[model samples]
Target chain A: MKDKELLKLVKQAKNYDSKAFGLLYEQFVSKVYNYIYYRTGSFIEAEDLTAQTFLKAFDAIGKFDGQKASFPTWLIRIANNLTIDYFRLKGRRPEVPIEYACENCDDCNLEETVLINAMSDRVKGLISGLTDEQQQVMILKFNLHFTNNEIAKAMGKTEGSIKSLQHRALSKIRKILEEEDG
Target chain B: MDNKLENALENCITLIRNREEGIDDCLARYPNLRKSLEPLLRAALAVDEVLPEISPSMEFKKSFGAKLDAMVEDKRKKFVLPRKASRKRIPPCVSAAATKCFNNGVCNCLYLCCLRCGNDGCIRQQSSRQLTLPGKESS
Candidate 1:
């Protein structure tokens, strides 16, 4: 949706318009679900967290300000917070088994599927080694395609900090991959 | 870890992401850190390439939407307008706007008061107030 139209919807949603809120939900549900899925690595947990994120956003929509951060940015922030809370409550990050992650991709040849799953699993394993902040930055940057500015807003950090985090995270991942290759 | 090297690495990643330039250009720009940063950038790029995008299952999506609608309905019941106030017919737009506000989990009385005021400014003020409430402490 255009910024103007989204703002209008947000305004209406703020006034308690369920239909307008549903429109916002329709617009962002996939993105939010994808983001949570990447973070939690569990389809079931991602579904639950994604639902919680929107419910929280619904309850708090009256407070969203488009000027400070775009709607998706704000929503991602909420998703991130909920993911963190889930991790805290669970006391560990759940790894999605390669088989589980690859269950839906029936189009690929068997060998291609195996190769892709292996690479994906390797990449995710390496990423799991980074600090929480670094992992968050990498996922938001590479997976979600958030810009440094938007990420900074979502993560509540300065753009410079985000740049540094991304650099350090990438550097760490590179080192791990190099060691495996060697 | 060096500040200069970090800046060069960040710039290289940005350039690579944008497909603006090749690694040779980045290496030339930061000759001192090339050997260390080069492999890292390549590894980062490789990992970036392999990250998968997952979609929620259809059943989950349908169920979630239904669940959310039910929650909204339950909240609507909790904040129903009083009988005396409901007797005085409200403009469709105003009532719609007020209903929206109530659905947002705003206090029932506040929205009711705004509706009772029956002017654009009251609604606008209430909306502004609602916008600021959650953002003040957190943002």
Candidate 2:
């Protein structure tokens, strides 16, 4: 369905329309799951966060402002905020500086070497070197395919600032990889 | 070969690092370089790469839906939202301009309804046009 239709469904959902709510849920669950998964990096955490994101969206659907952003973007902002809240409550910070950092290697034919747990150690080691902010931007941009403007909106920063931050963050990854190569 | 390869590698790295072109643009340009450079890019990407697949669990949804239904039914607990409603509802034709009214009102039924009605008609019309054109991009 188009944004307008989805928005209509969301409105119906707010009015306690079960069918409309179901349609909206179908429309947004994947986005919510992916956003949560991207942030938390754990299927379990993503699943939990996805649930929380929707529950919150459902609770606050009545107050959603379409003028501020599209329904998907608004939902994403909600998911992102909730994930941040989860981190705050835990008092645990991520070891990686960048967020996404993916290269579509899931199809690498070397299953034993690339796919399963074989590269986990190396991957984990590389990410351990990044800073928290870098990690956030990297994941949001690379993993989730969020534009600089969207990321900036999510992070409460200007687009130019986000572009610069993204550049610096990716540069750090390049440096780390270069060092590893040597 | 290493120096010549190094120059190409630098360009490849910058492109990959910048994410400028298609993901495999450099690899396509230099097959030999691909053999040498892909591992590095792969390693760089893999580091901290978390592939959390989205589980479309119908069971989870049903259980959660049931729980929410119970809460709403049993508690009759009304939760007050953070923002106040500004404009209640606006008619369909006036919607694009009445974005202000939609934002002001807490209930979005009228606004969404109007948008949906308009979009549904527009999309239907576009589809009919595409069918006649046959070779168009099917906008």
Candidate 3:
């Protein structure tokens, strides 16, 4: 939808229009789900978090200020915060479930699924070793395809800091891969 | 790593992703940092490859939509209905006139006329006259 139309729908949704809210949900559900999936590395948790994010958004849409953030940015921030809270509640970092990853690969053949799962596990393991900020930057950059400035806005960081974070993350991942190969 | 090299590597990555520059151009631009930058770029590519796009299942979408509908319905019941009911409620005198008009089969026009006049006393007098009529007592 165009920005003008989306803004109008947002206004209607703020008035508790269920149909307008449903349209916004349809537009954002997949992006929000994929973001949480990458962060939590678990489909079940991602699904739960995505639901919570939207429910929370629906409850808070009245207070949402368009000047403060676009709808997607605001929604993604909620998802990111919920994922953090999930980690705090569990008292553990997210773990890549290789079996779950393999089972969810509907588009890949058996051989391709196995290889992709292996690579995913390894990469997730490597990323999980980084600081939370670094991991988030990498995921936003590579997985979600956000530009540095967009990631900065979503993360509440400067674009310069995002560039440094991406650089450091890549450098650390390279070191880990080298050590593993040796 | 030196800050310059780090900045250069980041710029190279951006350029390569944007198709503005190739690996050879990047390597030639920073020959002294080639070895370090190359591995980092390769790791970046590997990370990109490993990040798969997983979508929500059909069951999830269906259930979530149902759940959202229920929540919205509940919210409407809690917040919207009361406000609308309050806004549409007719005053007592107007309601009496409305009842009399209903019996005469002219309520729609009477109600619209009352709304246009915006006079409670007018509606009250109108209703009192109707009430005095013997046959209209039921109204």
Candidate 4:
């Protein structure tokens, strides 16, 4: 659904409309699930995390101010925060190592070796080398098709900061890829 | 980066944005830099294609929907259910009488028993003595 339609649902949901909330859930669960899947590369973990994300979002949606962030961005922030908390609780960072590449086998049905072979190691290696924050921005922006403004909103950073981070990340990845090819 | 590289990067960016716009259309639209940024542009174009599609399972959706319904119902029930102050409870004597008084709400029923405070004691005495009904002697 479009953002305006979603906002309408949100308004109805705020008044305690379960069907409207269900529609909102259907609209966002996949996007949120995919974002988590990209970060974790574990379907089971992604499913569990996505469930928690929506539950937390529903609980807190009453206090959400739409002026500050779009609903998707807000949902993403909640998901990102929960993923971070999960990692912190596990005493590890939430990252899928480049070596353990997965290409949504159910969607595309590509094997691990095929996925790893499809991308130049240079891109994957550089991405893996990036700081967690930078990597998240790149993944959310370039890989996941989130706008810089949306990334900024989701990450709680300024738009200018997101742009600079994206530039630096791209330059670094480009340099690494160039070096590897040279 | 030099102007050439910058222009190349800009072209790459535009191409990446329009990557989903189809290759022939992109090639026809911007013929100049497509040749230079071909590899990077191709990679960028294929990035999303390579990204796996993740779908929630039917079972998970059913369960999640059920869970969401339950949670929302639980929240709604909070408002709809009677408040503590509004809930009514019959006095134990009235409840007992209701049960013993021929199952009718009429207080004037012949079987009506109003033995309030000592009802339990009287019932216990009758039961112990095996008295079947009122005015009966344990023989």
Best-matching candidate per lDDT: 3
Per-residue lDDT for A1-182 in model 4, tens only?
67788788999787667888888888888888877766765667778999999899888879988898988899999999988887889898755543343455454335544754455344355556666787777668655578767999999999778766755666666566567679
- Candidate 4: where is the Cα deviation over 4 Å? A98-126, A179-182, B1-50, B80-139
Task: For candidate 2, write residues B60-83 as lDDT tens digits.
Answer: 566666765554333222432212
- Model 4's CAPRI class is incorrect
Per-candidate Cα RMSD to the true structure, in Å, reads 16.0, 20.2, 9.1, 13.3
Candidate 1: Cα lDDT at B132:
68
lDDT of 2 by residue, A1-182 (tens): 78788778877767666666666777677767756654565656766887787778777888987776677777778887888888899898754222332335442234332443443454355555566666666666655556666777777788767656655555566676678789
Residues B1-139 of candidate 3: C-alpha lDDT, one tens digit per residue:
5677777767877788788988788778988888777888788877777776556776788789888977887898789989999868878999899788787778556766656675688885665564476765655
TM-score of 1: 0.68
- State the lDDT of candidate 3 residue by residue for A110-139, as single tens digits: 665566567776766677777878888887
Fnat of each prediction? 0.43, 0.07, 0.57, 0.25
lDDT of each: 0.76, 0.60, 0.79, 0.68
Pick by TM-score: 2 or 3, better one: 3
What TM value does model 4 have?
0.65
Interface RMSD, every prediction, one decimal place: 3.6, 7.6, 3.1, 4.5
Clashing pairs in 4: none
Model 3 chain A lowest lDDT segment of ten: A96-105
Off by over 4 Å in 1: A93-99, A102-119, B1-37, B73-139
